[model samples]
Target: MTNTPQPVPASQPIPDSTAAMKSAVKWGVMGLIALAVVGALLAGLFAGKEGVYGALIGAAVGGGFILFTALGVLLTAKLPALTAGAVLLGTWLLKMILAMVVLFVLSDMDFYNKTALVLVIIMSLVVVLGAETYGVLGTKTPYVDPTPSSNVDDDE
Candidate 1:
């Protein structure tokens, strides 16, 4: 019969799962932003003066909104359930505010571009909700205890 104890290893490796996932999301968002910028530039070059300008405005506004989507996801991941909901709602509101700001700026530049601004706002709202709805609702996973408790009794 052996009662020997095993030695535990020191210096555990730091887990990078979350960091890696976040980095992947951030880079993905960045790639989309780059595409939007290029589209805006091409629109400006090929489309008429107003069309080009409107696209550039949309790209700026939409890019900011998209960036917030990633930021909100990252921030919510670091928060507790209720706090994450709060942050998600706040991020949505911020996106709305930015959309409004974009509208105001674009409005002053051109009269016919109002529709585009509205579209931007609607699209931003949809994207933010679509991306974050799951996250906000996903915090309440059922808890399961693996260890057996000592309180159970068989004699009723």
Candidate 2:
């Protein structure tokens, strides 16, 4: 119950905070791939080759769109907060524009099953985001207290 802070011995290594985030991203990507395969198989079973094509395209565009943000954050973890935020914000805007353009471009194309494409994209987006959220919330990461302790006996 005491607020007194205990010093960490140099012999004891600190836990890596980014490890949790990394694991989350890894699991998220794996989940997306798994979903893609399952979605493709089911779509193909119902809609034939067109379904498979639609599923693959949907997975690439939808899943990749969302996953790219997590990747940007991971890559910018070492950068200043403002810089990272700016980069992420910029990428997000660009991503949105590209996604819209892609969907619009494919709207009239009948090469793939539109239903299959739309369904897979929706499923992938939900499932991958859920997996990442679960991974992040389920794991624990340690952080340091930035404020200095009031202990007068502590060595400078």
Candidate 3:
């Protein structure tokens, strides 16, 4: 029997960056939650009830930051390149200001262990950031045709 060639189907378009951002957010949030739980447990061991409260507050702050940043990324991904950059910058500035305000407000509360709060917040941020970096870097996005045929005779 003569050799027969199979038809190649057209590749579907790659999902936009917003889809990637959404995935990253999901991963980041999961990482943050896991880290927060660990941090709370450590705090409870080290400082008891006050430590637990502080740890929860810290996790909440960090989670808020992650959500805000992710929302900004998702919203800006669809804009023109230059516009997206500007919007992202603005979003970052806003995030920083809001975070500062939150910390300032939390500092005045006399109940929880401030030291534990600060420590957990910092740790949670680092963990979430690391997780997001890994998720983004590890994702296998196709920059070019992912499947290439190697039939020389078929090309003629």
Model 2 spans with C-alpha error above 4 angstroms: 1-13, 146-156
lDDT of 1 by residue, 72-146 (tens): 767677668899888889889988887787666655565334444344435544443444444434334324443
Per lDDT, the best of the predicted structures is 2
Compose the digit string of candidate 2's lDDT tens values, residues 1-156: 336657767896565656667867888899899989999999999999999989998998888888888888888888999999999999999999999999999899888999999999999899889888887887766566635646745443
TM-score of each: 0.54, 0.84, 0.76
Any idea how many clashes model 2 has? 0
RMSD of each: 7.8, 3.5, 5.7
TM-score of 2: 0.84
lDDT of 3 by residue, 1-156 (tens): 444544445575555556667777778888888977988899999999899899989888877787678778788877898998898889889889988998898778877888889898888788888877776776656554445547546444
lDDT of 2 at 49: 92
Which 10 consecutive residues of model 3 have the lowest summed lDDT? 1-10
Candidate number that wins on TM-score, 1 or 3 = 3
**Per-residue error (Å), model 2, residue 47:** 0.4
How many Å off is the CA of 126 in candidate 1?
A: 11
Ranking by TM-score: 2, 3, 1
